[model samples]
Target: MEISARNSIKGTVKKIVHGSVNTEIILEVASGVELVSIITKSSAENLGLVEGKQAYAVIKSSDVMLAVE
Candidate 1:
């Protein structure tokens, strides 16, 4: 499929947290680096996102923020 997003990182599904409205997906892109994305439950189900599955984090954004504690 064709997509407009330029950032596409391949990763494995580490964990999935299902909420009442949305689902939190944690993807391990590298040995220590990980990315988290929150998507609708229906969308997640449609994509068949589960642990140990391979997926891509398709990022289509203009800005990304970083924080420090």
Candidate 2:
């Protein structure tokens, strides 16, 4: 909520793919524009990420992270 990173895109969770170690999440930022973020499986679950849920795609330097409230 109060951080330093400036590159943040609000979008809805579009898709999710689970792997053994990581999970792939796709966020639809715009009509056809989407951002994909790969995070740890436990992290994804901890965030309660699900399709149609609102989330933020935080981009800092070369890393893309996901955040929720």
Per-residue accuracy of model 1 over 1-69 as CA lDDT, tens digit each: 678889999999999999999999999999989999999999999999999999999998888899999
Alpha-carbon RMSD, each predicted model: 1.4, 7.9
| TM-scores, one per candidate | 0.89, 0.87
Task: Spell out the clash pairs found in candidate 2.
Answer: none
Off by over 4 Å in 2: 62-69
Candidate 2, overall lDDT? 0.96
Candidate 1 regions exceeding 4 Å error are: 66-69
- How many backbone clashes can be found in candidate 2? 0
